[model samples]
Target: MHTPAPTAPAHARPRAVHWLTTAAATAAVIAGAALLQPAAATASPDTAAAAQARPAPDAQAATYPLECRGGAPRVVNRATGDLDGDGHLETVAVVRCDAGIGTPPSGVYVLTSPHRVVATLLDPGDGENVTEIAVAEGAVAATLLGYSSDAVARCCPDRMQKVKWQWRNGKFTRSATPDARGV
Candidate 1:
């Protein structure tokens, strides 16, 4: 005759099973704690310091190109034309400066050669803002918006003057009459 093997009650498991469950729970808790840590906490000291020293995207130090530092040269407007009449297109960049408070200084840079600044057409604080800039037919025109007189508020522009610079004799000159429609 055949005989059946003995078995434990359903409510009670083997001692080995209890130890296995406890080990799994402990591992899960450790994994959760590891995942909860901040990324900076895992970074090296040098990496953390570099991240802190980095400038904000909009900061003046970040805005200006490596070559130009004067006036903090934040390029607000740009145009391309044969500004020097060399049959090659030159760049005209209107930049704003970070000078103290109020309206920062502004200027225009003429790039006769590629990536090389040849001359500064306008200086900062000469006007409130460079409303528009364009180069056409060997002439560069800039619309300067600013107070007509000291009596007017610095924030308000009582006049809009159109200035023209013509490329001649290896340099640019201010023209008395500005082109009405600057290209």
Candidate 2:
């Protein structure tokens, strides 16, 4: 006679299946906890490694070249002084102011050569505007003040380039007044 294979009972089989399902659920929870961690909540092992991989915020550029379009540069005036603090004015920095007249555009620049900018500064303020620029002795002095335009005024002019370079006793200062009339 051939023997028959034994079979598991339905009731106990279901209980055993329940324990297996519980173990699988627990494993899933542990796996999810491992993956759901907040990165910045604690200083984990790789803090130094992270710092090495990022750039410092305070880093600056070492050198920059100067180039611009729409305006050419020239030295309109020159003075004698030690502007660069090297005891001589051989290193000349040029400055210029461009303005708008009805249909023309305006801008300003400080130049160290025919094509170099030692420093570029904004040329407008609360009660003043730079209209003319010249370099002397190594220093850049610009004419500034309120000026009258046909669009802004009518009678008595009431405007002029109010300041000039006062190179006194090897030192320079800006003097201002009024009456800067322009188009």
Candidate 3:
């Protein structure tokens, strides 16, 4: 006659059940985490086509409006983003007159495809230098260094201003950021 296998001891039974419960809970957690994970991104055909159709404007190839006093305007800093929600990238370039001595003020220009200057965000005539520039979420931000007065030396800027530009209503609007303060 066939005989049944021996079972776990009476006192050990609870421990075995607890171990199994813990394992099941751990498995359930793992499964839940897997379900909560974000799905991998896949580009749609239209997005791929749009990307191919429009590329970021070349900052180096564009001609700026700044009069360099017979010297060439140089691109000092550049950032790219779709500033106008046009589904195409635009280039924001910080340009300055190539000077040998003191700090020359910078002009911020926006360039569209084909390397055309479409907007001048910061004019060199404004007498401020761009210390930093960035583009994000269809907006351009910059830290400007300037003098407190005509008495201040050009080499030393005593004022610091943080500014931002966003495209709205067919034009770019300028706003001072919260962190603007004296340097």
| Estimated TM-score for each candidate | 0.53, 0.29, 0.73
lDDT ranking, best first: 3, 1, 2
The candidate 2 region of ten consecutive residues with least summed lDDT is 57-66
Rank the models by TM-score, top first: 3, 1, 2
**Angstrom error at residue 158, model 3:** 0.5
Which model is ahead, 1 or 2, in terms of TM-score? 1
Please give, for residues 1-183, the per-residue lDDT of candidate 1 as tens digits. Answer: 878887778757658888899999999999999999767756445633543453212222222332344545567877767666444666777777655566654677776433666677787647657878887776888787766578887776777678888888888887645433322
Cα lDDT computed for each candidate against the true fold: 0.66, 0.42, 0.92
lDDT of 3 by residue, 1-183 (tens): 999999988877767789899999999999999899998999766754675677898999998998988688999999998898767889999999999888799999999989999999999999999989999999999999998899998888999999999999999999999998998
Clashing pairs in 3: none
Residue 118's lDDT within candidate 2 is: 43
Rate residue 58 of model 2 by lDDT: 18
Highest lDDT, which number? 3
Q: Please give the TM-score that candidate 1 achieves against the real structure.
A: 0.53
Q: Where does candidate 3 stray beyond 4 Å?
A: 1-49
* Candidate scoring better on TM-score of 1 and 3: 3
